[model samples]
Structure formats: C-alpha cells, structure tokens
Target: MQILSRPYGALHYRLDGPEGTPVVLMANSLGTDLRLWDAVLPLLPRGLRYLRYDKQGHGLSDLGQADRIADHAADAEALIEAVATGPVVMVGLSIGGLIAQHLAAGRPDLVRALVLSNTAARLGTPDSWQARIDAVEQRGMASIADAVMERWFAAPFRATPALALWRNMLARTPAAGYVAACRALAEADHRQATAALRLPAMVIAGDADGASPADLVRATADLIPGATFHLIPGAGHLPCVETPAAHAALMTPFLERHAR
Candidate 1:
C-alpha cells in the first residue's frame, strides 16, 4: 500500500527487507505490476532491500500522459533518489528490461548492476506494435489475452491452473494504461545507448519465449561488453513468474557479489 507522490500522480511501490542494505529494484513488464516479481522475492538472498512498483498505467499506480521510455525511467530515478542511499541492482523483465536499460544509460549512478530477462533493446517493429495497439484499442485487453498467454508461458505452464490467474491479470489491466505502454514500446529503441553501458550486467532469455525470442535476447547481450548471458530452458517470456526458483538461482550470486 506504499505510495510515492509525483508530478504525474501517485505511484504504488513496496519496499521490503532491511533498510540500509543493498537494494534490488524490480520493474515489471507492460501488462503487469509489482507482483510480477512476487514469486522470486522470497527465493532471493536475504539482508537486501527489495523495491518493486506498478508503473504508470499499470497496477495501482497512476497512468500519467507519458508515452516514452524516458518518462518511465524518470519516475524510477525519482524512486531511487527518494529511497536508496546509493546505487541498486536492477532486475527487469520484458518491458521492465527496457526500462532498466534506459535507467542504466541515463542514470548510471543510480544502477549498480543489471539483470535483463526476456527483453530486447528494440522489441517489435513500429508496424507490428501498431497492429497490437489497434487490436487492443478496438477490442480491449481481453481480445489479446490468449495470444499474450502463449507468448508469456510455455505449453506445460499454460496447462496449470495458475495460468488462469495471470491471464486474468492481463485481461483486467486498464486499457488506457496498456495502450500507453504499447505506444511507448512502439517507439523505444535502446540499442545505441545500451551498447555504450560499461557497468556489470547480466542478460537472460527463456528458450520458449515467443515475444522476445532467445536470438533477440542474445543479441541484446552481445551489445554489452562483458555481460553474462543465460538461457532458461522450458520457460517463456515471464520466467520470473513461470520459473522463480531458476530465476532466483541466477540472481542470488549476482546480488551477493554486488551487495553494499
């Protein structure tokens, strides 16, 4: 229930674990909120601050008029300055990953390391994203829920009852919020700036991810100088949700290495 007041509106955020410890800032994908990293939190190493928030237009947060990645990154920069004493380890998924890249490039001082999962510098092309925007604009969020589920989860996970919960989360998202995010994604291209980042970074991909395929994820990894790349087998776009244990396993050691 924590909320941070900003020019756009109130942003919903949750801060857990001890104060003064290293912070892990997690950003969710387009249609999700802070809960996107819920399953992975308890599995992570102890004695660290975990900060997650619902981006503008998602979760319980305000959906301002912002339609660019930089605007979203600016909100995050405000969060870091308000709560953190120093830089943080940013772990982002899907569009969250794009947000991380933008932050690390624009506010490198606020980010100590990065874990980019199931995302790319440039996601879908403008035309492809426009088509998606048109679909949702015309039929609403539910219209694309099934297609999104396929890209989000592998067949095995889709068969589980848990799948329905996430599907509903997608369908229930605010259309305006979702559309704003789609507009942002349609115009974002971070490759040029991300390739210039020099800090520690890790890139992860789900072998079964249809949205950001392995090859695309690998190409993003190739852009950064010395980034460690990993592939999670049998997982899809949202691996932190589908395979939290595996996701945390990769993140634990990295957190320990960079802990303040």
Candidate 2:
C-alpha cells in the first residue's frame, strides 16, 4: 500500500522483485486496479522489478479527472520520476495499453520495451463512450457490470467462482474514476503516435475478446515496426485473469530478451 502524491492527487502503487534489476511498470485496465496483474506477475522472468499502480479514482488511488489520454501519460511520467526507478518494460492492458502507447512515444527514455494486452489504439467513437458514461452515471457501476463482464471474460471463466471477485471489483470502483476513464477512451486516438514508435513491443490478444477483438489487436500491432503478436485461444479481454499462464508464457520471454 504505497502512495505517491501528485499535483492532481495521490496514486496507489506496489513495487516487487529485486531493487537493482530492470523494471516492469504495469498499468491496469479501466475499472480495475494494480491487482489485475497479480496472477501474471509471479510467472514473469526473475530478476526484474515490477511496479503496478491504480490510476486515479481506481482502487486506493486518490480521486481525480483526466480528459485526454496524455494526462494519464503525464501522471505515469511523474510516477516513474517519483519512484526514481530506471527505464522499464511498460506493460499495460485496455486503457492501460493506450497509456503505454502514449508513454512509449512521449517518454521514450522511461520505456525500454512495451507490452500491449487486450487494447486498441482507438476504442469506440466519442458517442459510444459517452453512452457508457451516461449508463454508469445514471445507474452506477452495477448498470454495466454484466455487459462489461461478458466482454471481459470467456463464458467458462464467468461461470466460476472467480467471476464474483471481478464483478465486485468493477462494481466497487469509483464512478468518477470509471467515467473519467471512459472519457479518456472516448477522446484518445493514439493511431498516429503509436505508428511512429520504434521500440520493441509485444501485442497479445485473446481469441474470445469481445471488447478489443483479435483483429483490432493485430491491427494495432501492424502499426509498430518489428512488433510481435500472440493470440490466447480461450481467453477474453482480461487474459491476464482468464489465462495467466498463457499471458506469462508470452511475457516472460519478452522480459528475458528485453528487460535485462
């Protein structure tokens, strides 16, 4: 339970692994916190430090607002500086992936490699995201939990006990935080920026992903030079939760090859 205070607000984060090793900074999906990486973290390559943080308004982080994805990227820049950690392998999911792309282009010095999981360069149009925000605003997080869960996990995973935990997490998220993220996704268009990044990158997708389908993931990967792409057979949007081992299988090698 570490908190780093920023001009906007405080961000809750956790650091793990050896102090002197290369770092891996993880950004969570919308409506989730740093814990989203729990299942996949342990299976990563040894000797690399990991930093996970909850974006403002999510988890233990302070409540705040962000209209542009760049604002979130700037917050991440401040976070890395506050931690005094060295260059990192940036790992992000969903909205986190958009932030990763923003960081890789804007603060290249802080990112040695990048992993984009279950994300797109551009999500839905502004109107679509606005509708989602209206739904949450009027009815609370519960209003969209079923639809989000259906998109987040495969049917089989949703039938298990784990589904309850994820549902609770989503439902408990701050409306301000969740809606702010929705706005960020609505306004964010990283296609031009991401297309110019030359950094080493790995893009992972789940075949069952309804939010960011495999085709969308592949298209994002296509924008990068020399980026590798992988498809997890039975997983959905949140593959780290649905198929941690499979996500790790793809991540460990990338970390081993690049994070060192």
Candidate 3:
C-alpha cells in the first residue's frame, strides 16, 4: 500500500519478507493489479523479499494518456533501481512478462533471473488490439469482459464462484487504462530484444491459454538460448490463479536455483 511518486505518475507497490533477503519482483497482467499475485505469494520461498506493483494505469496506480510498451519497462527499471537496489529474480505474467523481457534486456545489472509466464514475444496484431481498444472506448470495459474472461480463465474455473471476482475486475478496469494497455500490446514487438537476452530465463505456459497459446509461449522461450519452457496442464492464461500451487511448484525451484 505504498505509493512511489515519479515524474509520469505515482506507482502503487508493496514489499514483503525480510529487508536483507533476496528480492523477487512480480508484475501483473494487463487489466489487473498487483493483487493478481496474491494466490502465489504465500507459496513463495520464505526469507526472500518480494515486490509487487500496479502498472501505471492498472490497480491503484496513477493513470496517464501515455501509451508505449517501453514506458512500462522504463518504469520497472526505475523501480528496481530505486527500491530493490539489487539484482532481482524478476517474475512477470502476460504483459508483465513483456515488460520483464524489456527490463532484463536493457538493464541486465538489475535482474539476476527471469520467469516469464503466459506471455508471448509479441502479443496480438495491431489490427486486433486496435479493434479491442475501439470497442472499450466506445462501449466501455463491459463490451469486452466476456471475451477476455473466456481467454483468461479455463471453462471449469469459469463455472465456479471465483469467476465472478475476475469478471468484476475486468469489467471495472478503467477504459483509458485498458485501451492504453491494448495499444501498448499492439505496438510491441520484442522478438529481437528478448532473443538477445543472455540470462537465467524460464518461460511458463498454460496448456489452455487462448491469449498466448502454448506454442506461442514456447517460441518465446526458443528465442533465448538455454531457456527452459514448462506447460501447466489444463490451465489458461492466469495459471497462477487457476492453479497457484502448480505455478509455485514450477517457480519456487527456478527462483531458488537462480536467486543464489
């Protein structure tokens, strides 16, 4: 519940675990906040510090008219250098993963290792993302909530009560925030940059993720030499939510081995 003020806007962030422990920074997906990692927090290794933040327009963070995928990366760079102040095991989901790639590529000194979950090197086509942006602008977030939820959660999870909370999160997202993020995704192409990154990297894919399908995530992993790719069966885009324990199982070991 801390706000880090910057020239662009204020970033909402929270820190946990001990002061001197290894740091793990977790970034959230588009249209969601730092709360996206709530399920996975307790499962993380003990005695390690954690940092989670709301991207400019999402969660409790300030919103602006700016739109650029790299802006998110820049923000992350500043945050890591200012607050964490040490090499960190950076973990990100969806668009957060894209930001992680950008940060690690540009500021390798700040990142010790990376965990990219359910994200692609490049997301969707400009036309497709623009269409989504237009829809959100004209009809609001509700216009795209159902379709987004379909891709976000697996069918069985959608049938449960937990789906309601996610639906509300999507529907309640600011139109400007959602559209700006869509524009960022549309314009972003990280294949060249991410492929050049030489670090301890791991990519996790959800077997049923419609947004960034398994093959697409796998290709992202292929871009980085020696990067490992794992698939969480039956999970969708938000595997950390649909199967937090399973996601932790994959992540804890990677962080433990690399955090040293």
Task: Give the per-residue lDDT digits (tens) of candidate 3, residues 43-101.
Answer: 98887888999988888888765488788888788788778858999998999999999
The TM-score, computed over Cα atoms with residue i paired to residue i, of candidate 2 is 0.98
Error of 2 at 21 (Å): 1.2
Q: Give the TM-score comparing model 3 with the true structure, all chains together.
A: 0.98
- lDDT values for all models: 0.92, 0.91, 0.90
Model 2, which residues run further than 4 Å from truth? Answer: none
| The candidate that achieves the highest TM-score relative to the unseen native structure | 1
**How well does model 2 score by local distance difference test?**
0.91
Off by over 4 Å in 1: none
Clashing pairs in 2: none
Candidate 3: the clashing residue pairs are: none
Ranking by lDDT: 1, 2, 3
lDDT of 2 by residue, 97-215 (tens): 99999999998999889999999899889999999999999999998999999999999999999999999999999999899889999999999999999999999999999899999
